[model samples]
Structure formats: C-alpha cells, structure tokens
Target: MTEQPNMDAGAATGTKPLAFDRWLEHFRGNPAYHRLIEADIDWNGRSMLDEPTRQAFINSFQRFELGESGDGKRLLSKAALEGDPTYLAALELLVREEQKHSALFRRGLDHLEAPSLEAHWSDAAFTVLRRALGLRTELGLFLIVESVAMGYFTALAERAPDPVLRGIGLRIATDEQDHIRFQIDRLRQGFRNTPRAGRVLIGMAWTVIAGGAAAVLAVDHGPALRACGLSPARYWRQAMVGFRRAAHSVLANPGAEPLGPLGKGVH
Candidate 1:
C-alpha cells in the first residue's frame, strides 16, 4: 500500500525471491492472533469434551462455521457482480468450496445432534460493511479473515489426535490453503489496479479487522488453552514460528510472482 518495491518480480526473473521478513515483522507485532491459534489447538485437545461438553463445543464450532460461510457467500456474490472476470471466477470457486466446508461441518453437527442457528446475522454484517466501504474494502477484510482461518485450520490439522478429527481438519486445511491462494491472487490484481491512496486505506482496514478478530478469538479461547497441558504463551510462540515458515514458502515461491504488488499487505 505504501508502494513497496515489487517483491515478487525477482521470482519472475528467475532470481532469488524476497523473504517474508515483512510478514514475520507483521506477525511478531501481533501476538494476539498467534495466541488465538494456540488457544484453539489447546481447547480442541483438552476442553473439547468427552460427550456432554461435545454438544456445547460442537454448537460453538457450528456457529463459527455458519458465521464464516455466510459472510463468504455474500462476499463472493458481491465480487462476482462487481469485480473483474478472472477475480470473480476465482472467488466463485472459493465460494462453492466454502459451501462444501459449511456442509461438511453441518454434517458433523448433525451427526452429533447439534442445534442449528440462523446465519443471517453474518450476511447482514457483510452487507452493512460493504454498503459502508464499497467492494474492495470488503474483499480486503475477507482476505485477511480467510488467511487467519487458514493458519488456524492448518495448525489444528497438524495437532488433532483423533483420526476422524484429524481427517476433517486436514481437509479443511486444504480448502483453506486454496482459499488463501485465491484471495492472494485476486487481491494482488486489485492492488495493481487500485489507486495508491485506496490501497493504503484498504490495507489499513484489513490490518484493523484482522487484528480485532484475532484479539477476540484469543480472549474467548485463552482459558481453554490454560486448561490444557500447554501454556498459551509458549504455544503461541511455536505457532508463530510455524506461520512464519509457511509465509516464507509463499513469499519465496515462483508461482507467487503475480502477487508482488500485494506483498506488503500479505501477512
């Protein structure tokens, strides 16, 4: 947003790529988000209930999916209507994939006999935000949220103990990784086409939204982590290291050359 050098260009020219130092810098400055991932892992491992607690935990987890997928569908529809063809197509694919995720979670909930709540509130929130700030801002918010979710799901997949849960986590993680790539590709194109001032505003908005969401998750899940054998602070440090390594892979990948323009805002 601040017109950083084209970080992906080196990869395009078959040269060594720019490192993810910027992303790591961003992550280090926001331990709150890392804490959320750690707490989720801790909770899933410890507080996730044997049977009675499973209902409540499943309900909460379902609500989270409902909220997230509802927002994703709305954002995708809006993007299809207003964005470029390539971007919109990718977003549509993501939307369909997210629907599958939603259904997958719903199946799990149903198998556990969990109650379903209306997800209209999530849609309402997205609509309000879009009306207030326009499409690009909404997309930025979506991307940041999706990125955090990707990291969370990936970490959970790596730590899950139960075979079924591990399988689900890994599947969701794969979807999330694809979602991240789609968002990165579209956001990069958007940044290239956007006015410098507008890009800055969107980046700032994304940072705020991502940071706020991370804080909320950490607060909600921190106690759960404490209940587990893991310390929240320690788990957070480990997760950050993992996230940094993943970010490095993306930043250094040859295929990510097209994302050069948006590199500054990727973390």
Candidate 2:
C-alpha cells in the first residue's frame, strides 16, 4: 500500500482537525443513494413528440451512463492494483452506485425504445491520456464530469414532463451533488500531494473535459431547454454559474499536506 500522510486529529491546536479518511468512509454509502433508487421514475409511457428531441435525449443519457461506468471501473481497478485499500474501498462502493445509475439510465432508454447507445469517445485520446496520467489526473477529470452532470440532471428534472422522469432526475441530482463533493475533496487533496507539473496538467485536463462535456449538453438539450421555458443564453449562463461555483470550491479548499519525501518511499 502507498504510504499516505497520517493526519493527527489533535495536531493543530484550537482548530478542528480535518478527518479526510473518516469523512471519505462516512460517505461511502450515502443515504442519497437509496433515495435516488427509490425515487426513480418509469419513463415507458412518455413520448417526445419530436423525433430529434427524443433521439438527442436518448443519445445524451446513453453516452453519459457509458462514460460514468467506464470511468468508475477503471478507477476501482487501478486503485486495487496499486494496493491503495482506502481508495479501492471507496471506489468499490462508488462504482457500484454508478452501475446502478447507469442501469437506470439504460432502463429508461429501453422504455423509450431508443436505438442501442454507442460509446461516445472511442478514440485513442482518452486511453492515451489515462495511461499517461495517474489516479490524481483521473479524479480531476471526474470532478468536471460530475459537476457538469449535476447541472444536466438538474435541468432534466425541471423540464421532464413525466412525473417519474422528473422524480428520477431529482433523486439522481441529489446523489450527483454528493458525488461532486467527494470528487472535489479528492481533487484538493491530489493538488496538495501532486507535483507542480502534474497539478498543471490536471487543471488543464479538467478545463478541456469540462468544456467538452458542456458542449455535449448544449448540443443534446438545446431545444429541450427552450421547451422548458429557458432561453439558450439563460441556460448557458446558469450552467456557467454552476460550473464555476463547483470549480471555485475545489480550488479554494486548502488541502491535506503532501506526503513529500514519503511519496518516494511508496514507489
């Protein structure tokens, strides 16, 4: 196992000690998970009158689920192979929950009778990037993905005409919020421990990924937003605000101390 810096609860006098590991473990199976599962809506009866609108939503949802499941599985596998038991455990639970999310999205599509969804990013770019970077880099990417997903789900919940779809979106959005928080915390910690070049790479990668995801949403749901009483400019502005808020929170947090020379020992 990689040696992580042991945080002493009483080290900083007069200040509440930050219990990173404890908090991570505490949120492993958040109540939001159960709530989301329970609140999921059946979308079988609903119909999007426009073919383009229905197709776009189906494509977006499918790609989103595939991306999530792929990322989760990769993270869990890497953590386990690296012998980082704490991260591995956390990711194990997280991946399971993500699988549920993916399954629900898939089921929703089946209800709509949309065509089979294909992987969105099948090129070598993602694979090469993943191989070149470490877990920290992956987490940075995930932070952006989850943050954008939160916005997309929130919009879906507000606009979806079907009660079940709306309920599902709300519940999923809640869980997504928790996921975003967890990822942001992890990114902060990663920034602290990672090398300068690595940190810069992470930041750049996050920006690119965030931008790409946002574009995907815009392309997929532009009309949907209009239908929901939101203009293009308004939806874009709201999305920007949400993304910035999430990014700011991650950047602002003073993270855990770096492992420093101990990082060498881990290798």
Best by TM-score: 2
Q: Which stretches of candidate 1 lie over 4 Å from their true place?
A: 1-49, 52-56, 71-77, 81-83, 119-127, 193-202, 221-256, 259-267
- For model 1, which pairs clash? none
Sliding window of 10 residues with minimal summed lDDT for model 2: 258-267
Pick out the ten consecutive residues of candidate 1 with the lowest summed lDDT.
258-267
Task: Residues 72-154, candidate 2: write the lDDT tens digits.
Answer: 55666555554445645665666666776776677666765765455555323555566655575666656666776566677
Q: What's the C-alpha lDDT at position 158 in model 2?
A: 76
lDDT of each: 0.48, 0.57
lDDT tens string, model 1, 1-267? Answer: 333222234334554433433333432333343333334432223334466445533644565557545535556556555424444555555565566667656655554567666754544665576555445555555565566455445444555433334445555665565455544554453344345556446455555565555544444444433333334455454444443333333333325444322221123
The true-versus-predicted C-alpha distance at residue 56 of model 1, in Å, is 5.8
> Would you estimate the TM-scores of all the predictions?
0.60, 0.72
Q: Highest lDDT: which candidate?
A: 2
Clash tally for model 1: 0
